[model samples]
Target: MLSRLRRFTLCSLALVPFAGPALAGDTSAWSAREGTAARLVAGGAQEGSHDGSLIGGVEIRLPEGLKTYWRYPGDSGVPPHFDWSGSRNVEAVEVLWPAPVRFDDGGSFSIGYKRDVVLPLRITPKDRSQPVDLKLNLDFAVCGKICQPANAALDLALPPGGIGAPSAALTQALASVPRPAELGARSEPGIAAAELHHASDGATIRIATHVGNAATADLFVEGPDEDWALPLPARETGADGRTIFVLPVDGIPKGADVTTARLRFTLVDGDRAIEVDTPLSAR
Candidate 1:
């Protein structure tokens, strides 16, 4: 009878499933580097999303006095890169950048976020019925006295039903992204005009902006392509009571037509910012 009881106990134990590590939560474990650390946070399916899109974010934490670059790191800095090939059931992932503050790097001015930042991600699932597994390999730079490259590998899984609710951090990050605007927008903190002027030395782009405070307003310009390294715009007072920003056209790519090149302008004032894309034309 004792042998029979022992055999029955063994059978019952064999039938029971083995326990493993717990499933990941909405936020992934932090992947730490030298002066920075990063993680992935799932914001679940967006409410009332038309295309079944989901919201997520890459949160980067930096020590005091350290900073990370924007999509186009001004003057001299390396931008962050993301690789999501290892993910499953993901059709596309769009990274959105928040408005960054301008800071001095050595003697040159650079644009980036200090302390911490959450880059909002808009994700589309290949199979909405199945869970989406996200695998990211993020490579970014952190600068203080000097710049250094940092890498983090992060993963998170989102079920079809979602993580119960949206993430507030992601919501704020999304709101911080520059709103799209047209050239010559009349709104405050907007681009009023942009024109190319020719001088004996070379060509320069002059832009006029409307903002509450001229001292706190700034403008950043990007060429049609990444190869066109445009300089930061310098602020000046316009004769017509608008704030003017001027930049010399010194970094045009060879063989590229300056008159037809489409330029992107990011105008920032205080806590408000706007992005405008317009063609370059001589005044």
Candidate 2:
């Protein structure tokens, strides 16, 4: 039997320090942690350029068993939000999501990380050679069987030069971040349409998965941003075990058209990872 809502409880690890003081800055910037197995360790920082802008990321690690949500928290959570108001030189920060996996939490399925992961950010540096101090306020929700929301404030300082060299652990952790699956292995595009119902309260998206074998296919949604902290939506199968899923849009942008939103998701059943991308439109 497919699982239901009441069974899931999300556990999160925001900015928990597990090791020595990171070379760039100090931990005094962020708040406290709640999860013992899932703590944030300064994965390190980097300086580079994307397009023509100064770019880099504040790397963080979420180890095994403990999962973190994606920008589009499939069904019930909010994505991680970071406020970088602490640095004067910092112009902006954009998160880049590596791919994500579909997991059955409680009885509801969603997209996120199950083990070690890294989140890269594009930052405008004050001085490439001089040190830059950053203070960030982050928030997210995690689920296992009981859901709990976590909040933190973190401070990191980057020294002159660059983030230096990445440790072997960082390299391995990066490898675990989800990436886009091969297109050829995906199902046909017309198999589903996520209809959004916008109202004064919020948005509600109904995902209709059209497949020959509903029991063999599962669905997940990715967000337009990098912090995957959104909640896993509550889902229900119709009489045929294949039908529409009603998802709450509490954190989603109100009246925003998902029609143009660039999204990528996977349909995993057994060992097959069927990737799909939806163009902006309403059914």
Candidate 3:
């Protein structure tokens, strides 16, 4: 039987210390953290936009020796939680996560950020003509010697024409987002191949991508939804002369047919990362 998996939330009672715009001069910043700050930015809302979706984001500047977690916090960290209850005209919120580095958190292996980071949001509005009032109550954990829980309430009213001045922080953040992976496409920032093998326990996923430096590379995998917590990936050099990563799948419903399951992989190498969703197979 498949057990229900809820959002990975930890217990905490620390006073929210962040709640305004970040220090990088974004006016929509809402500072509400202890050692970090948070800001909300909206863009791509111009005349005759073809995508029909608005791009928004939250920028977090991590001071020296501070770090934050990704959507999946690896082994023993907290994943961020966003509450859009106060949002107006928002139909959906699709979060775009950057590649994370693997490190030890509280003596346990984990995956997260070692420096400043940005979380871009792809928002679908109910009415494109109307302005969007983006209200975000973001709860995330930042760590140094101790893990600290922080929260920030931010609101941005995105009107047409977007920000007059281009924000370097946001521009860089948008660039860092992973490009979609294409198997056998033989392109820069693309996936070479991915293979999955099923077992009695669950499954093992193997992926290979083109990378310049293997030592600085890392791969992170995510399950079908926010509730599934998967293990970290192991890196190795394939016999076929490609950078390979293997991940063991475990936390899923018992007897669930995962032969056709889909998984998302984020390959992070230095300042570049790409994302791809690969389907599982019985073979």
Candidate 4:
């Protein structure tokens, strides 16, 4: 068995040299590690398209039964951190996360991806007249029995005017990202309401959603900022054909105003999911 110390030591050696620069293809060469590998993929835009944003992706591949953490890792694990400071002809980059599945890590539940995932990127260029060069330094963790840290440096370039057809891989990845929805929207697979209930013991949040199967559904909550490490909500019995989840109002930072807090809720039911952002409110 690989001990924790040995796993980390091997992981450190894996990062000694960065992967070579991307060649002619829209996808970069895979940067392979012990149990994981990563590559950057470019989704070219249609000719003469002026959508103002270009699509790209960071693809991470994990061995079967191994996993990686999401933006919020739940009970334990490190979220992926990205650095693009080395890029040229780029103004901003936004990484969009696909819906993550729940994992039973020992007795605790963690949220992340299994097998492989392509985190789609929406990039804005400083000058549309010139090609955009993208450099990515990705830091993430992979876990099975023991979690291990991994890093990859990747590069990709997009032509001026965002020409070329979007890659099929990136198209599928972009489709997996949760679509934004409003609270109380009467849409399938949507959050109906989020109410806060206070008692002598403590406060808990109740969220109601409209999904096909309540038993297989799951909900994840995120506070306004990274400082808030909110606990994963538990599924409970619901009424009126709605799925219910309850989250204890613990993990709020000291002196933080609960009323002013904007919570982000990601509701996942099998292959369907939706993202809802709204202010906290009392029942």
Candidate 5:
């Protein structure tokens, strides 16, 4: 946990961090407010696993009927972007995404969170002995009926022996991140078995997700990196009590083969969801 300095006013935060941003830091939770409130979290110093570096969490509060985007925003949504040029003492920031649900806006499909969400970030400091002045400039879009752009310019000041406190909300959000899984690794109970077949443009992914009512379920697929924008999964069912989703992969650059490319899946069953990362291959 990194100690927070609440010395800055909202007016200052809205202006200063925009000057320059470079994020690589250590510490717990620090929050700033905008249209939707955002908090910076410094983690790992609480449980005696003080490895100098910290896993940070950005807690975003979404009002009812409002939604934010995942890294890949499916058919018709803009993804969130971060600018760390305004930060200091930071080396790198790794964005970790939680499982997302598919939302139908008219006829277009989008993937994101309808309620509050916390995005886990891995932060590495340049020096452990030194403190970090963490700043963030996040640009994102929120949609309900009309889509609007949103921004959060947050700041956290920490000195030596300073750490941020742990947050239950942030902790739970981090816990919701997708568990790692391999292709055809169905031995894990309650987990869906995923397989793939080659297609003309890319590949087709089949996921054996068990659900009582297939109509109530939703599926989201992500590509290997942020660049590979795959489409949402198409839902299907068999005579058995299981449901299968066939996703046609596309959006990769020319000459890129999706069969050998890694993929991710997020299956949403009502309020419950699970995420997995694996590769696809021809049957």
Candidate 6:
């Protein structure tokens, strides 16, 4: 057993030297508010590893009823982006997404987590023998009818040592990133678009027709900002609950094209969220 352990240690050490630096010189910590559209708090650091890899994750806290978007925010929202270009002794970093919840706004939709979310991270060391340091600049979006864009920088240090279990915070985050189910179920990518037309009276919009069906779904739009008013859209049901809807352009533009609005919806049968790239057309 002793001989085997030693051999394993040597092999691990060899892989360590080849590892790249993701966090080595700078170490700062950063966080975001819990209620904003991008209600995410993230931090990064270097930690002990067997083969030059560090275990880390971005911790996010979501307020009740609020949500943060995934890599693809669906129709109207923007996804968060992480940058570590300033760190030294770091070659690369990768993000591991936990399963997300389906977010619906009346008849529109998007995919994201509500309560809280923790994003997993993969860190590689630049030097196997030296303690590694990491710095991260994180950017992401949050929404509740209105959307918000946020950015922050964090620094962390990892001592040269053996790997250990994740922190309590990490454990909680893992719980939030739910596991996916039923791979055999055929479904669209779950992304849709919403185009809002701001007219004299009220806003009018349209959602992608590719969603499950009209009767079983509801529509919602994140107004023009990340924290604004988004009235629930009226649903028009058809045979088998599948129908196309055309809302009035009361307060939205009459002839606005696709770029002006964003739409999201949720299907009732399953908790699946569908997003639409809806564009406005003349009545």
Output the TM-score of candidate 1.
0.88
Candidates, ranked, lDDT: 4, 1, 3, 5, 2, 6
Best by lDDT: 4
What are the lDDT figures for the candidates, one per model?
Answer: 0.79, 0.50, 0.71, 0.79, 0.64, 0.48
In the range 1-283, model 5's lDDT, one tens digit per residue, is 0101111012122321222223334422333333455656665432443545666677776778889888777776768788877667877777878778778866767778899888987666677667767678777776766666666666665554335544676577666776665444444223357777766776677778765457877777777666666667787885676778887655665667776776777766655556767676457
- lDDT for each residue of candidate 4 in 103-134, tens digit (9 for 90 to 100): 88877677899878999888888886788888
Candidate 6 Cα errors over 4 Å, as ranges: 1-50, 161-164, 172-283
Clashes of 2: 44
Per-residue lDDT of model 2, residues 192-263, tens digit only: 555667778876766655444545555565556543223444456866555455656434355444557665
How high is each candidate's TM-score? 0.88, 0.54, 0.83, 0.90, 0.76, 0.48
TM-score ranking, high to low = 4, 1, 3, 5, 2, 6
- What does the lDDT come to for candidate 2? 0.50
TM-score winner: 4
* Model 4 stretches astray by more than 4 angstroms: 1-18, 33-35, 46-51
Per-residue CA lDDT of model 3 for 98-130, tens digit only, reads 667898765566777899887877777888777
Superposed by TM-score, candidate 2 places the C-alpha of residue 176 at a distance from the truth, in angstroms, of 4.9
Worst 10 residues of 6 by lDDT: 9-18
Taking all chains together, the TM-score of candidate 3 against the true structure is 0.83
Please state the error at residue 179 of candidate 2 in Å.
6.0
Error of 3 at 140 (Å): 0.6
Off by more than 4 A, model 3: 1-13, 21-26, 32-34, 44-48, 198-203
